[model samples]
Target: MSLLSFRVEQGDISRGCGFRSCCWTISRAVISSGILFRKKNQVKKGCSSVNDDLFVITDAPIHPEEVSAKVESRDAGAVTIFCGTVREWTKGRRTLYLEYQAYESMAVKKLAEIGGQVQDKWPAAKVAITHRVGRLEISDLAVVIAVSSPHRKAAYEANEYVIEQIKKVVPIWKKEHWEDGEQWIGDQLQQVEYPDGKPMKGSGTDD
Candidate 1:
């Protein structure tokens, strides 16, 4: 996996010249044979993380039930599952579909990183997160997060925390296929705080 270099200036994030390297790893996993393959299922290719906590980035379709099963246990009286999907409309544009990519190694590591934060924040919560890469049609499942805890509130809060963290720190990128054309977007949720300039938020055919 290649390291990403970005600088913060004037309270905005700007990408480094090696910016191309950011998605270079993603190309190998998602752009096989010049095609972007996004299955309706979660794609499982390698070991997920430091724990058997089920944090993964895949091309296969995500099944919430399966993810939930992995984290659910008798010690947990409450189980919360959050599924993120591709919406037909984002901002004002109508997207036909979306293709996602990621720095696989770093992505899973960051996922586990989020898992660590969740456990620390909610001692009783158990968390599992799965993300899919490749082409996804509108309304297709993009992410599944499972959090189980003895208290319902802990499970709920941990679930939200993991999702926000993934969108902020993960290496996953997406291309919005609009009715007119397609463009590669930055991070999972760019609308959020971009402390620095958001250079990767532009759209173009030239990757």
Candidate 2:
């Protein structure tokens, strides 16, 4: 299976463990479960797992400096950061804004789980992630990830891993607001379900 596919399945189970417990479990699983198992050829190419910390937020702009500070400490010799910003275009469509909704409690819990996995997968100095919710306009800050390690390579790898994992597992829904109309992104990450015995409006049509 692809890396993302494996993560989607295992991540679903890990998210169920609640915030604190999930973190510990993810940490253990990454080390023992071979989630980042590299092939012999990949290992020869010097490939390894990345480690990072995650921060998730809703309806708030993310400050990179704040996340960097949180991930940095005396022991960390290098820090890497990534910031995701809202853009006006997606897939050739003009996006006016984005409306984000999430299962807040579960989202936070899942973020903690990702952080723990980072710690276990590599000798990460520290990791932090933050996500914004509510309506976001073009150029608005949406998400931030920061990682620190004893070397530049580890920091870079961890930063990449955390962002990819969030896209796969975090229980956040995104609605694309366009001039023509609004369409919710109901991908594999966010399944659509309606109330019992009720037919959802626009259920069949692409909104």
Say which candidate scores most in lDDT: 1
lDDT of 1: 0.61
Writing each residue's lDDT as its tens digit, candidate 2 over 117-186 gives 9899875557877777778888776666767777766776777788668767766666777888776663
RMSD of each: 15.5, 15.3
At residue 105, candidate 1 shows an lDDT of 71
The lDDT for every candidate, in the order shown, is: 0.61, 0.56
TM per prediction? 0.68, 0.64
TM-score of 1: 0.68
lDDT of candidate 1 over 1-207, digit per residue (tens): 221232111111112210110000111122222222333223343333324647878787776656766664667766666767677765567888878777777777778888989979898788888888888887687877878887766876787678778767877777667888666666545543233432242221122
